[model samples]
Target: MAEDMSNEHSQDDSGLHAWMLAWYDHAVSVGFIRPPFLLNDVTAERLEGYFRVGLTPVEGAEAFFGVAH
Candidate 1:
């Protein structure tokens, strides 16, 4: 599924999108309301990557429609 979202011409989101989505699913499977995300500004490849994809700003977000920027 990660490969599907990384299409260069359609959307240039970094690999971070895959990692973030994985983290969210994993956290939910583990029954976590708020997962302690490891990726941060220090690790994120680019700040803009956050906005290109559809996801909560915080991984494993407690609520939907969460901030992604």
Candidate 2:
């Protein structure tokens, strides 16, 4: 029924960000998807995003996922 919206293409522009923020708010209000939540905290909803998007093993496992700090 609600096939009007298209989240396929990413609008990385600043203007798009603002527009999407408003759109997300409205969509949540109308029950399209649940509200956004943090990944660290085990809350209502958390987007895994990409399952296999982490470090490669053996070759340079230590360098992978390394922080600047």
Candidate 3:
């Protein structure tokens, strides 16, 4: 049962990761600013915290991962 729960959690995480990547790509394609770094360090919890603060994903990514050039 624990193994099954772990698998489910993994699947959910992968799904969220895929959605976030796709959303970021689309945002950039539409002229949203890209972050200085890759999304590799971003996590679901961090993203959720941004959401709770009322930022759109694009804004959240910029605020959390973007560096001034």
Candidate 4:
């Protein structure tokens, strides 16, 4: 599923997009009314990957989005 979507975007952007989606889903699941940022879908898959590796939401967000300056 993700591989199919990745075909439509450049490799770099595809990864970023995937992570953004995952973060959005996590935020929503944690009770945020909406995503913290615009995310615009391998979301479940990427989120699952993060969980499989034992990454907490904060860790995953930081790893993907980077720590805000």
Candidate 5:
């Protein structure tokens, strides 16, 4: 059976957004965001790619986000 996802994108800029932020924070704590996230500025799309492809190396992560080496 398919999971119910009707409200997945419904609560934008609300509690759902906060929950997403919490998930990001968890990722940071688990070293998923890497250090100096400010300098790198990883976007959501790039992060999705990281999850899809697995193991986003520092160089690849930098290049993926268009950060100058």
Candidate 6:
């Protein structure tokens, strides 16, 4: 299950920064996948999976996934 990071930035805790950073990093990484259709029924779960996998190093993939593009 996905962790709720809605208030992650509100906390003054040091760990929150890492959490939020990871989230934004993941979001940017997956945003460049180029889905089949814009109006398609895309869900967060599917996107989350892409983001998770995108975080890893894969053959033929960019050095920084899609985040740097």
Query: Of the candidates shown, which would achieve the greatest lDDT relative to the real structure?
Result: 3
Provide the lDDT at 22 for model 3. 57
Tell me the tens digit of each residue's lDDT in model 6 across 1-65: 13447455344344433433455454446663542424233443443344445433232133333
Q: Write model 5 residue lDDT over 1-69, tens digit each, in one string.
A: 133354543543354345445545665665667645553335655544554454434433444444466
TM-score of model 1 vs. true structure: 0.31
Assess the local accuracy of residue 1 in candidate 3 as a C-alpha lDDT between 0 and 100: 100
lDDT of 1 at 17: 62
Q: Which segments of candidate 3 are over 4 A away from where they belong?
A: 35-69
C-alpha RMSD of candidate 5: 8.1
lDDT of 1 at 11: 49
Candidate 2 lDDT by residue in tens digits, 1-69 = 233333333432443445435544554565555756222433111111111232122212223223547
Q: Which is the leading candidate under TM-score?
A: 3
- TM-score of each model, paired residue for residue: 0.31, 0.33, 0.53, 0.39, 0.32, 0.29
Off by over 4 Å in 6: 1-12, 32-69
Supply the global lDDT for candidate 1.
0.50
Location of the lowest summed lDDT over 10 successive residues in candidate 6 = 55-64
Candidate achieving higher TM-score, 3 or 6? 3
Question: How do the residues 1-69 of candidate 4 rate in per-residue lDDT, one tens digit apiece?
Answer: 898777756764666556546666766666553645543246456655675586766567555555567
Worst 10 residues of 2 by lDDT: 43-52
Q: Each model's RMSD to truth, in Å?
A: 11.5, 15.3, 5.4, 9.1, 8.1, 10.1
- Measured by TM-score, how close is model 5 to the native structure? 0.32
Note the clash tally of each candidate. Answer: 1, 0, 0, 0, 0, 0
